[model samples]
Target: MGILEVSNVNKRFGGLQALGNVNLDVAKGTVHAIIGPNGAGKSTLLNVLVGKLVPDTGTVLFNGTSVLGLKPFEINQLGISRVFQTPEIFSDLSVFENMLIPCFAKRDGSFRMHALESIASEKDIIEKAEHMLAEVNMADKRHMTASSLSRGDKRRLEMAMCLVQEPKLLLLDEPTAGMARADTNNTIDLLNQIHDSREITMVIIEHDMHVVFSLAKRITVLAQGTPLVEDTPDNIKGHPKVKEAYLGEAAA
Candidate 1:
């Protein structure tokens, strides 16, 4: 069995069938990419994985434990972390200060923004945060305001924050969205580095074919809230269903 598994999952919104009977298996220590056209239920499935949304009739198991009904932070405690499309950070705070917030997170999922001022006396936490920042190549920008950084740097800092928590599974929603080519390439390199250096498993939901092809060990193509195909990157590239999903019947 894979480390994370979704079995017979279904979700609906009034008259809209947001997710059909969907299933996904993400093995340990591999990068799995889920790509599909707009409105293909990719976001819905991702939400289920992260505990933000519960499936109506399915099981989302992380290491054999059911994650349904758990809160987002509760899921985080289970070694799952999610990076949203837009970087989630304290815009006014310095990059280092933003990094310190996660370090002070309480077991009950509470954080004191003012606690940052007291972090100086916490030598170990400081060291750990600094190490993570350095790992993402953001150490030099530690004192810069998070809002002042470029989009790529913001992504780097956000990733550092997630890495500091040391999650076993990282879910990225369009990690390279809205990035220039240079930033996108840099993000790709950073993700490759992280994958090479850690035992973490990543599940990415992306629209960019380049990002998906560049990072995924396995790819699942979703269409109209169902998985059309799942295979290695090369096989997915030549998949007729995938072509029809993105392009019309002509491509297929």
Candidate 2:
């Protein structure tokens, strides 16, 4: 069994079937990409995995334990961290302060934001945040207010926040959604560096094929709420079903 498993999962919203019999297995230490046309239930599936939306049926398991009914922080404490499509940060806080939030997230869904007095006294937490900022190339911007940073830097800070938690599995949702080409490519390189630095598993839901093929070891193509193909990047490159459902002739 893979480190993360989705078995016979289904979800619906009134008239629409958001996900249908979706089953996916993400092996440990591999980058798994979930790609598809719009409305293919990619985001919905991600929500399910993180416990934001419980499935109508089926189960999600992380490291052999069922993930159902767990709160977001509960899932995080279980070693599953998520980086959203948009940068989610404290606009008023400095980059360093923003990085400190995850460190304060207790497994019980309780949070203790360190005050200015405690912030200085918390030597271990500060050092850990500094190390993570340096790893994401944001060490120099540590004192800058998070709202003032560029889009790319904000994304970097968000990533660093997730990293400080030291999750075993990372879920990325359209990580490069609004990035320019240069920023997008830089994010890809950051992802590569992170993947190489540890045994973390990443499940990416991306619309950009370039990003998917760049980091994915295994790719699953979803079409109209169901999985249409799952294979290596090279094999997925020329698959006729993928061409018709998502990619064009260029991919085939």
Candidate 3:
């Protein structure tokens, strides 16, 4: 069994079926990409995996335990961390302060921002945050306010926050979105470095084929809220179903 499993999952919104019988198995310690064109239910499926939206049917299992109906923080405590498409950070806070937040995270859906007063005593947490920041090459910017950083740096800071938590499964939602070609490539390289240095499993929902082929060991193509095919990146590149999903029936 994979580290993360989705079995017969379905979700709907009024007249629209956002996800239909979606079943996915993301193997342990592998980068799995979920790709499709707009309105293909990629975002909806991501929401389901992170417990933001409980599906109408089926189950989501993480590390052999059911994650359905759990709160987002609860899921995080269970070794799943998500990096959002738009970098989510405390814009007014220093980069170091933002990194410290997750280090002092409470499992009950709260952050201990007040703990900053006694931070001098929290040497272990401080070291961990510093190490993670350095891993993402943000240690030099640790004192800068998060809002002043460039888009790519902001994304890097956000990634460091998630990594500080040391999650088993990292869910990246369009990790390279809104980046320049150079920034996108740099982000890909950073991700590869992280993957190589850890035993983490990544599930990516991306619109960029370049990003997908660069990092994903397995790729799943979703069309109209259902999976069309799941295969290796090399095979997925020219798969007829993938072409049909993006280019329509004529190309297929």
Candidate 4:
């Protein structure tokens, strides 16, 4: 079995069927992309994976354990981390301080966010946070206010924050959304470096075909809240159904 599996998952909102028996199997250490047109339930699926939304009649299994009723933080404790489309950071804090937030919460059973005073005494966590920032090439901006950084840099810092947790599965929702070509390329290269350096599995939900083709080892095409096709990048490129559902014939 894959490291993460979603079997026959269904979700609904009043009269709208947001997800219809969606199924996904993501192998360990691979980058999987899920793409579809607008209103295709991509965000909902990501939410379900991260325990923000629970499925009505199916199962989400991480390493064969049911994650249905788990809280968001509970799911994080199980080695799953999610990066939202927008950078989720403390706008007032410096890069270094933001990086320390997650690291300071590592405790047994329950986790606590260490206050600034408490964090000052933990040399090891501080060092580890610095190392992560350095790896992401943001160590130089350690003291820079997060809000002052460019959009791309803010996204980089956000990813670094998620990486420090050493999650088994990383879910990215439009990681490169709103980036210019240069920033998009930088994000792609950074992702390649992350994959090469670690054994983390990623499931990215993206609308940008360039970003999807750049990082996806496998692609699942969703349409009208249902999965239409799942295939490798090459096979998905000129696929008739995929072209119909997402990329038009001209795009193909």
In model 4, the runs with Cα more than 4 Å from the true position are: 107-110, 113-117, 247-252
In terms of lDDT, the poorest run of 10 residues in model 4 is 106-115
Clash number for model 1?
A: 0
Best by lDDT: 3
Note the clash tally of each candidate: 0, 0, 0, 0
Best of the candidates, TM-score: 3
- Between 1 and 2, whose lDDT is larger? 2
Model 4 lDDT tens row, 97-172: 9998778654433554434556578898899999999898888999999999989889999899899989899999
State which candidate, 1 or 3, has the greater lDDT: 3
Over the stretch 135-235, how does candidate 1's per-residue lDDT look in tens digits? 77788999999999988888888888888888899999999999999889989988998899887899999988998899999999999999999999999
Model 1 misplacement above 4 A: 106-117
The CA-based lDDT of model 1 is what? 0.89
Task: List model 2 lDDT by residue over 1-252, tens digit each.
Answer: 899999899998999999999989999999999999999999999999998999999999999999999998788889999999988889899998898878767321465543555567778877888888888888899899999999999888888888888899999999999899999999999999899988689999999999999999999999888998899999999789998887555665
Task: List the global CA lDDT of all models.
Answer: 0.89, 0.90, 0.91, 0.90
Residue pairs that clash (backbone atoms under 3 angstroms), model 2: none
Model 3 lDDT-worst window of ten: 106-115
TM-score for all models, in order of appearance: 0.94, 0.94, 0.95, 0.94
Clashing pairs in 3: none
Candidate 2's TM-score reads 0.94
Position 131, candidate 1: lDDT: 84
